[model samples]
Target: MSNESSPLQSSLLVSERMAFKLHRQGMIMETIGKNNAVCNEYPSPILPKERWRYQMVNMYPDSGQCHPFGRR
Candidate 1:
């Protein structure tokens, strides 16, 4: 509300109504970022939660059987 404030200073000042809204929105976005950050650290797993188990073993078909050169 200061007449003395330059255009840039006035533009950046948060109004009373906008202050609360902006602060709340910023906090929500930060929380969402943190919650999903861990998943981004690793490559996606082949198995979904419903099929994967703590002690489960993954069995692969013979790779060399299909290769034209055969197993090396």
Candidate 2:
């Protein structure tokens, strides 16, 4: 039909951009728990509002924060 992305695709693109921006701003914490050497390590039992700042368990396969299967 048209050379335009569907609504779902547009939303996904926006989400990706936001995630990238957050990551660049250091607002997205990539690790948690004792293993990470960084000072800004995210809390293990992450609070509700703080949850958005941490990397998603399912997204980071090699992260020590949680297993790729989504278990911490």
Q: What pairs collide in candidate 2?
A: none
- What does the lDDT come to for candidate 2? 0.45
Off by over 4 Å in 1: 15-20, 25-27, 31-72
Q: Which ten residues in a row have the lowest lDDT in candidate 2?
A: 63-72
Q: Tell me the tens digit of each residue's lDDT in model 2 across 23-69.
A: 66667564644655645554233222334433344544755552121
Which regions in candidate 2 have their CA more than 4 angstroms from the true location?
1-3, 32-72
RMSD of 1: 25.0
Each prediction's total of clashing residue pairs, residues at least 3 apart in sequence or on different chains, is: 0, 0
Candidate with the greatest lDDT versus the true structure: 2
Quote model 2's TM-score.
0.41
RMSD, every candidate, angstroms? 25.0, 11.7
